[model samples]
Target: MNDFYSVTAQPSRPMGGRRGVFRPGHVQLPVSGVTPNVETHVAIAGDWHSSGYWARQALKMLQEQAPGVRTLLHLGDFNLTANVPWSAYRRNVVEAMTASGLERIFVTPGNHDDWGQLGPRFQAHPNEPYRLPKTQTIAFLPRGYRFTVGGRTFLSLGGAASPDQGKRIEGKDWWRTEEPAEADAARALAGGSADVMLTHEAISGGSRLVDDVIARPNHRLFDERGLDASRRSRAIVTDVWTQLSPARLFHGHMHVRAEGHHSAGRSVYSLAANNSPGNIGVLDLRDLTWAWLD
Candidate 1:
């Protein structure tokens, strides 16, 4: 299938996404079936493993791709902000973004991040999104955190299963808190339908492109226990998905750019990894129109 969508041509078919919820580039709305013409836009980013150089490059790309973008919604894999080197680079995250003409960057914590520090912060501000340093331009969106931007409401849930779980040390590199808990799903469901959903783990029931990427042999984990745990993490997202039913869901982790619309008119866009093509996209939240560069 063509990954590129034409501004003039029509979205031809249903690509079969997320059991029954999301779809591809050409989205079909639930009520009007026509895409809106809203102006509020945000830079949508994929995972940034933990490189200061890549971080700056990603921001530079965002500035060029969607100039004047005031905010950036990073899908996950921002890395260990609580640790050294990582912390040093993070302190510069806001400065780089501000130079790129962006105001803020919010992360949905990814598996590669240091949840040892983030988990406690979540407990302290369980109901809201809080700045990482209260003075930094970076903020963490707690699980089940809901907010509105550009007249559209959003739900942010960050966490994913690391295929390399058995390859990393706990408390030092990998934190057990990187996976979403049952409580997180419960809280996310007790809210109104979201106009847009941002998550670190892609919902796994189905989505041809996403499923195909997930099935790749390179991503397989020999750690059966870790694989099982990964499935459990996905289950939580799926369960929350069935209830909230957001019109659009954007996620990263698969590290492949994939889009497919659900039969019900909603859609899903899985972003690529940092330093890769399709790693970033510019989304106009008002109308849900987005464009990503190669």
Candidate 2:
């Protein structure tokens, strides 16, 4: 059990409301407990990147390590690149999860997951199934989506700017929509508070230990893109936290395990990359207690 450092989110300033604002789709799924008197376990992981091999291995490990897990929550970066077609990515992920005997999965999209590019693809391929069985999985949550399981509410907002975009081609590997719009953020906050918050990027305001783990060297090609991107992400997460005031937050992007806390007893857990062995966050829905299975 690792100790977490506590920090407090500053109060959010009031912003004027926008009329006729577009809101992302809200999804709610129902999950049943397998047995009575047993705590429903939810397994959380990060950055699977659609690697069939990795997904297979990771899910198998999860089953072995946390056999009681009833649901799976992914914190994003599920695909290798935005260049890959959404159909291919979806197929790969579904097949892998099915093979691993994982039925229920909820995911928030990361930068590499092509956060914003799926709209047109869905329109173009009208017959292609984009969503899985709601009872089995909620494949993708764009932004401002919330789902409930075992009497606990989880809000998920997914998107992150890619510092490595400089090395990739536009439309093929990079997308401008990797970050959420201001309106999207506002809409997410308007949904009110949640018991647990899930996102692709960790909040910027954390203890020095967290800062140290998230800091990355600047790339010559992208200059300060990494730093700038992180700052932007931090601002968004900060706003979300200040407004929603969730008791617990889980995110994935840095690909390292770290934990932090807020003055109000809000715990923040950043998970390790899902492709790695033994990287899973186990949550006890009965009491909201969580820990790393690794």
Candidate 3:
């Protein structure tokens, strides 16, 4: 296939940034003795239905195609409806990751993670704090987080706000507040020299922003509110890009596989959703290769 995607992390002139090991706990027993300079393979997927069928399939594919992968990440949108049982879905995800022999698995929240209505009953559990390691602060925010794997760093950003949520916040808006969160995140990434950015929603500015792509359906939240979610989501995205300018930004939500290079005067990979077999995202590290199973 002519549509192959691969990007490598090249060390920029060493700027003397603090280095730290990832200590986040995983459902699959504790991991000890992580070596530096070791290549890490990671599998990322998101926007799963509440039934967890897609998550299960993605893990199965990872096991078969990217065996020996050290970590897996689910960006968000794990439930089909907010009313679905998270314990059941989490159990499914953890079981699959452990069965695949992955060292760790990380997850971020999506709009559907909310407790009522179309959202899932997802609150930060003591067992799972919805947090990941950062090169800077140890404090974790529910909005977003970061982690490193395969000798590269990844920043995961949350999605846009819905109209209902907006009304509750009064004058608060998603694009405005989310921009700061994303900007601060980018500063952290820049400070850490992060190599990649991952989010549940696509970044609309750079190559991730597609032409003629209807970011939201007519009757959906975006349409009813006149907010192009994909474009609005980009406010945070471009903010990060303007700062860290990571080598890649992998995202899910469109449910279609997309690949494009951003002309941000630098190489920034914009990866689309890998929600299907044909549209999977493939990344080849020096030692280990991972395919983002849809």
Candidate 4:
């Protein structure tokens, strides 16, 4: 098993000054032995919930804890509400990345991010690729979208069925499109194999490490019980895993930290929200080994 260490560290500069609510201090994990041959040091995080405070803190933590990271991948649920202004979301995310010294950021939309409000802003134009604002070095990936970086092929599939949909105001807080369509799953599997796969929901048959971690007292919010919705969501993710057979699969939305190997030989990891300490997952593409970082 890999050992973990926490050391006091500071950012290259002050992060957003003291006003920044999420101030990170004294947490660092060395990647010396784990990443020797790794072509990419990707930092994975999830469920920011649009809290600028946590976003700043999480990015700062990632910078200080895992240096030399090449890409920042946010699994999903980036905003608190789907109705948040696109411009505001863009600005906050850009500032955080700038402070963290990140040049490239890729995001997938979670249920909270898919509220009907974001559909028009992120909808793809005919024949043109969907992309986020250029001012911010961020790109939003649609379900089944695939891209490559650092010689690793990564596929992105985003969406989840919200258990609390009944409580949310239709068109403003919840959207039917929050779940993946059959076509989206088909498109995701069209590509032969992926070095890495990213989603907001976990596959069906992985070890119950994630469920076990989140089912603890006071953590019941992570567990939802709509059988039909659960099955649909799991089916899509399971199908994708079976088809692409990625070497590593990463997901968020459960808001817990856990890792386990799937039956298909893929290593699956679930990350906690940015608001929680030690919520980052660092993956070394060279060997597909990973560890949690604050």
For each candidate in turn, give its C-alpha RMSD to the true structure in angstroms. 10.3, 12.0, 10.4, 10.8
Each prediction's whole-model lDDT (CA): 0.72, 0.64, 0.46, 0.65
What local lDDT does model 3 show for residue 247? Answer: 68
Instruction: Using lDDT as the measure, name the better of candidate 1 and candidate 2.
Output: 1
Global CA lDDT computed for model 1: 0.72
Give all TM-scores, in the order shown: 0.82, 0.76, 0.63, 0.76
lDDT (Cα, 0-100) at 251 in candidate 1 = 90
Count of clashing residue pairs in every prediction? 10, 2, 4, 3
Off by over 4 Å in 3: 1-37, 115-144, 163-192, 215-221, 224-230, 263-275, 278-282, 287-294
Residue 192 of model 4 has an lDDT of 72
The deviation in Å at residue 54 for candidate 2 is: 1.9
The digit string of per-residue lDDT tens for model 3 on 3-121 reads 11122342211112323232222122123333222333456655665556665676677677766555555555554223577667666656765676554555444444442421121
> How large an RMSD does model 2 have?
12.0
lDDT string, candidate 4, 100-215, tens digits: 77655677778777546445543543112234545524555677776654456788888887766655666776777777768778878887798889998767655487666433
Clashing pairs in 4: 8-26, 49-80, 278-294
Better of 1 and 4 by TM-score: 1
Q: Name the regions of candidate 4 deviating beyond 4 angstroms.
A: 1-39, 80-90, 115-129, 211-227, 263-265
Error of 1 at 264 (Å): 3.0
TM-score of candidate 3 to 2 decimals: 0.63
